[model samples]
Target: MDILLNVVNYILGFGAAVFVPLIMFVLGLCVKMKPGDAFIAALTLGIAFTGMNTITSFMTGAIQPAAEGLADKTGLALTTVDTGWPAMSAIAWAWPFGVLCFPLLIVINIILLVTNKTNTLNVDLWNVWNLLFTAVLINYACEEAGMGTTVAMVLAFVGAGLMAALGIKIGDMWAPSIEKITGIPGVTVPHSMTFTAVLMFPFELILEKIPAIQNNNVDAKWLRDHFGIFGENSVMGLIIGIVLGAIAYGELQAALTLGIQAATAMVLFPMVSKLFMQALSPISDAVGDWMKAKFQDGRELYIGLDWPIVAGSNELWVLTILLIPVELIFAVVLAPIGNTVLPFAGIINTCCAVPALLLTGGNLIKMLILGIIATPVYLMVGSSFAGYCTRLAQTWSPDSLAGMGENPSITWSTMECPDFRWVLVNGLSGHVVAIVLLIVWLALFVLLYKHMAKRNVEIKKELGR
Candidate 1:
């Protein structure tokens, strides 16, 4: 296959800060480690992914030119042009079934971990390009319904392998509260934007059965113990970068240089998530002691990873700077009532709501009411998949539409995957209204995964788990 697309484009051209710490120093010398602790745990996970890409490029260079100067001073005549997620991952790697969807999702996650269904060994292979951006837009909407392109690449690779087997059952329901806050037990985070927090677990159990939001018990360690060090988290990201640089640069020296680059991205995103949990705790303890000397049924394994190791909390940077002006004023007053396409680009405030604010465990009022009702349903499902993502970026990456400028006629990406419910279930899959909206969203995720697995066994018997 053209030498596996020239060795996956020469290891994605040495990018992810040199191929994710040279694939975690060759997965810590394929679990045998001790080559000077896998070269100091792959040079401290490539210096914690170059200090979380230099504090996410100083918080997207002070919030993408103040969100393209509030979408060019709010003259909202929107015509698709949001263009973020790296030009929709260069039109999902210029489709033709996106370069064998990265070795068919690493051979369907190693045949769902050698057929024991799954134990989630996903190994965040470069975020499998968000599952090959919804399997190259559902293999170009099942090759515009005539199918055959080898049955539209096996029906968009079994609908992106059933969304990575429902993101490994949402990383086995948040791997025991992320191994009780990073002691790093099994591990999780099967990603696709933290599996859209299973569409907000039945609206956070109907806002925790509203006895006034169940006594609101505002979290983030009670705003760092009732505002002690100016309620630190890098001083509330220097007061939300001096109120988003005084509402987009009404300068007090560019709002204190975007409040010292949002207080150095809230104090270096938890010191680059404690150097990516000290380089994934000795390769997650050498893959849980090589799955206990190669699995003798004590089973338990997880790993998966990415969602910036539980997105540096402090209520996910105060509900990502109060939902960046409520996702740019709800994409300018609900993009003419949800017909979609307004965001000029702020990458849905903190890269598509930091995987539903670490699946709402950092409950800044339930991630600010699920980012004010899912940032206008991700700007009307990224404006109903912005005309088939601007006709799959002018038919397979016209040099990513001449590098996003040649004057935007159309483009889209408020958080990736040729979006808006993957263009309403790959433009209504083979029809019958996308199999009755995929059996009513799989019977509302089997009654919200049996009411969040009986509210996670009554929150693990009220924490005496």
Candidate 2:
């Protein structure tokens, strides 16, 4: 047991950027790439991920202070401190059974791939804890319902398997959207974050029927053409930063500095995303060809990836950045309904924003609307999950939340990416309604898959493929 924990810790200690490229390198070798070629591809892939991580960190570091400042300006004290996703992740790894989720998830992924239930390989190793969190939560739920530890453990694994499959399907479904938006091919982002689109998908359908919202498409290109230099994401980012800076801190020099920084980050994203595409193209093709031969059915294989693959969208950043303060205000307004967790740590909220960007076809106005609509769900999930999250923290890292200023609970909006926080809460409450909700959720996915299949066909036609 100690050995297993040590090994898991060591591997994860390398972090997502280095770890993902290693997986790609091994996958490259398995698919029969020459070692030298695989090495080059792997290194390039790692570099791309590093760039994404660096920029993400840059944005978060730059933005969080203003976000926290906004929270301070609110002058309201919420009971639960939003420790963010890292706290949840740390708690998952600290759990003894956390390491066991890897094999369980892998076995499920293999069954899914072999049975043609899903094409995604679920190789985004770093985010496995997302499912692990569900497993741990379910384990507690079962135990709370008077099931013993052994039974709770079994049910937890069962829940994780279900979620793993759901996540894979979500990733497979979104591959076409990712390709359509980024023009990148043969790779799918299967992170739990994209699962939030499952909820956004319904709203998307409703908007589809309303021709006014559906027909009027406003994307980055549209902004660039209409607004000219100022419409460009870089310039808009500059303006937004100045506004946010002024809102948070009334200093002109600080606002200007933030404007320049935001502009630079916005412009650099496309360049790094291009490097990501360059690195991924060869590995993706190799895997697709290899799978076609191996399957004997001419089916293409898409390399499952992390969220950053799609995070390059200017639309995603725009929605996420703009919503940071708005979300905090919503939390304050919604406090009467048990929203105890303040929006402090996970303020950017790209997990939900990125998927909405794809689903709405990057209509800035629509994405913004969906974001506002979705904020309550996030608050509810975080507030509801706080007790469980706090228990986990108390069991594992008791001192971690001491400085956060209240009955601290983790607010990991990433896990709520329509990732079934409601379902988790229902199941944990030992209600039969959980079963109905689960069935409904899966049924929705069935319909979503069909929708995606048709959409993929249309996209292929458009691409002249």
Candidate 3:
């Protein structure tokens, strides 16, 4: 176990940009891909990841200062600090079981695949921290309850494995539509946010039943046709930036700078994602061919990836920008409802809203309504978990949330945030209600899969499957 852990650390030490591509190159070679094609694919994947990091950095640099200014200007004495996702990740990696997470998850995936239980070959390893985060939360809970480290570790592995299995089911459900958009075969995003689309499935159906809403639906196609060039995501991003900037900083220069930044982020995200897809093409083909030949059947397998390839959808960007103000307003006016953490507009817009829109068929109206529903969930969860997060950080890595604020703790508006919080409240803390809710959440996923499967023929046609 020590040797395996050491090997995992050494490989992951290079970071995702290098490590992921290196692993893919090795896997490609093992799969009998041409040496030149495998090397090019791996190199291109690295380049794509590097470009993505650059764009994300620029977006963070532009939006974060303004967001901080906005929070300060509000003068709210918020007890809970918003330390952001990086802090949360730091806490995850610091936990003792963190060293074991990578090999455990990889082993789980391989087991599932060999047993024919899941066709999703999840390669989005960089986000494995999420699974680790879940594990640590459970581990902390189990330890507090007098469970032995071995038992805690086993439970942690169970939690992480369950999430991966859930991701496979989700990737299978959403892959066809994603393929249509990116023109890349056999790939889907299976992150936490995309999984939340399951929760929205029933609501979407209810909304569609109402002709008043359905007939008057203002979707992406409507925007493209009515607004012409102004409806384009780049311009919409600029407009959103100008609005956000003006709100964050009451100066023309500041507003213009922010507007350009938003526009650049909106444009660059899709562009960088396309580079990723291009790099993935050869490997995707090789895997698909191998699967069909080995299985002796034409199974529609998918690679579970991160949420970049489908970023091009105009509905996603537009709805995300529109929800920024809504999230902020909820944070301020709804403080009574535990809205301590001010919404980080940039992260929420990119991470939460886009996945919601994509899973709901890019229906802008549905997406907006989902955002409205999700706001309170974020606020209450973030606020409630702030204390636990603070304790965990102080106990595990005292400096993890340092420099955010005094006694700073972190929370997230990302799709995984609520689930993480709920696990803490229910799974670890022995809150029966949370456990029940989780059971219901899984039940909802089952219902959603069945519901979608009933319309399989229609969905496949729509997705060009």
- All candidates: CA RMSD in angstroms? 20.8, 1.9, 2.7
Query: What's the TM-score of each model vs. the native?
Result: 0.34, 0.95, 0.90
Displacement of residue 463 (Cα, Å) in model 1 is 22
Query: Residues 175-242, candidate 3, lDDT per residue (tens digit)?
Result: 76677667787777777656656556677788879887677757656776899977776787788889
TM-score quality measure for candidate 1: 0.34
Lowest summed lDDT across 10 adjacent residues in model 3 is found at: 412-421
Please report, as a residue range, the 10-residue window in candidate 2 with the lowest summed lDDT. 410-419
Per-residue lDDT tens digits for candidate 2, residues 123-218, read 797888987788878887788888898988888887788778777877788787888777878888887776667677788788888887888787
Name the TM-score of candidate 2: 0.95
| Candidate 1, residue 359: how far the Cα is off, in Å | 18
- CA lDDT, every model vs. true structure: 0.68, 0.80, 0.71
Give the Cα RMSD of candidate 3: 2.7
Q: Which pairs of residues collide in model 2?
A: 196-417, 196-418
Q: In model 1, what are the clashing residue pairs, if there are any?
A: 340-383
Candidate 1, residue 429: the lDDT equals 62
Model 1 misplacement above 4 A: 1-69, 72-76, 81-111, 115-118, 121-136, 141-150, 153-155, 162-181, 194-231, 248-299, 303-385, 389-412, 417-465
Taking the tens digit of each residue's C-alpha lDDT, what string does model 1 give over 1-465?
Answer: 777777777777676656766776776788787778877877887777777767766687677787666666777666667776765775766665566767777777788778877777766676677676776667667777777788877777777777777776666666666655555566677766654555666687788788765566576667778878777777777878887777776778887887888887878787677877787788778877877788887777777766666655556666767777777777778766754565655453655566555555566777788667766666776676566667777777766667556544454545642233543455446777667666666566567656656666765565564
